[model samples]
Target: MKANIQYAILIAWGILSVSCKKDNYKAPSGAFSGRLVYQGQPVNVSYNDVYFELWEPGWGKSTPIVVNVSQDGSFSALLFDASYKLVIPAAQGPFRSLTDKTTNSDTILLQLSGNLTRDIEVLPYYMIRQTKFTATGRKVTATFAAEQIIKDAAAKDIERVSLYICKTQFVDGRNSVATKDMSGAAITDPAGISLQVDVPALVPEQKTVFARVGLKIAGVEDMIYSPVQEVAL
Candidate 1:
């Protein structure tokens, strides 16, 4: 009886060991990188202006994967090799969401496996054009033409223009250490615009200061900005 019991136990242990052998599974590895464009022009997507998201199926109520968009209207992120629902949330950028248009759906099916370079087109409320910046002793000047994406002069949408200055390269409305502005009045002709900022004498000398000009359209809630540039102060 003891010999028979030992034989059965050994057979059962062998079966269990084989069943528990791990399966060789390889995870999908891929990357996505792209720019945000509007009317064939790349947008200067500032911080917190937009997001890149992926919604994997079978993950009900799961948090969406997100990636940050840099100041130059470009973004990149890693993703698994699978079919996922890709979406860009509305009203996150300087422009209105392209999702509002019937032909341009904000969401799409993406099959990620390898590196990707794509552009997400948007309909901006406005765009800055022909921007030039020059830094003189303790002062910086910016000149630019503002082009409204929704150009109805009668709407009187442009609220103001401002010059942002920062000690580092991350220059924006919220990140600027100092600012100069034209606000509280309607901009009748955004096409013709100029602004300047005088760096504070209290600031210690640095190798480079970053600067940019930003334009605001009332009710847009976000300012469309010019390209940030390094200037010698």
Candidate 2:
């Protein structure tokens, strides 16, 4: 009886594989690709990801599609050629809540077709304009300015400005050796908000170190960034 069952399972598996090979299907031709921009400039999006929910009929609580945002804030996804009602999750971004439908525009839709490009403009809570690193003796100083473009609520902008030090050029909160965060106060500086980091503790004198200063919003999952700077300490 066991031998018979094994033979039957092998036949079923072979038939299933043959059927799948015969029914070759290609994904939809329609796709959505665009960059995240603020103040007419492309930006590295927070959280390094974007989540889009499908709100079509008979789609009862389906899992949302997740797209990885590139280093310079670009993203693309394969989608069917249809009008998709999209929903942005709460506390997923540094921008203000997409909720409050009565007071704000919460209905975001995508009329996407073949090779569609639609950019999403978000008012960043804080924009890191420039970052420069200089080493003096054993201490390396990171100088940068963050401009507060959008007046975020205290809770949203709760975390203070921070400077991250790492060995890799592509540095963020995730892959960092050390971080100096001004944790007590909310970063509300509309002008130049600077933070200094001691790079010698984490990096050697002959090695190349990378520094980036940014702000992590209290509720958001992604850390907003500044350009990375390389310094030999």
Total clashing residue pairs per candidate? 0, 1
List the candidate 1 regions with Cα displacement exceeding 4 Å: 1-28, 99-104, 152-156, 184-188, 202-204
By lDDT, the best candidate is 1
Our tally of clashes for model 1 stands at 0
**Where does candidate 1 clash, by residue pair?**
none
Candidate 1 per-residue lDDT, tens place, 1-233, comes to 99999999999999878776644345546888888888777788567666767888886848888877888888888777777777776657677655635435777667677877778777788788998888788788888888767665524376778889998878787768779888736445566677878887545768678898887778766677888888887
Cα deviation at 217, candidate 2, in Å, is 3.2
Off by over 4 Å in 2: 1-18, 21-23, 28-30, 45-50, 54-61, 97-104, 152-158, 184-190, 200-207, 218-221
Provide the global lDDT of candidate 2 against the true structure: 0.66
TM-score between candidate 1 and the true structure: 0.79
Residue 44 miss distance in model 1 (angstroms) = 1.1
- Candidate 1 residue 43 Cα shift, in angstroms, is 1.0
Q: What is the C-alpha lDDT of each candidate?
A: 0.76, 0.66
C-alpha positional error of residue 45 in candidate 1 after TM-score superposition, expressed in Å? 2.8
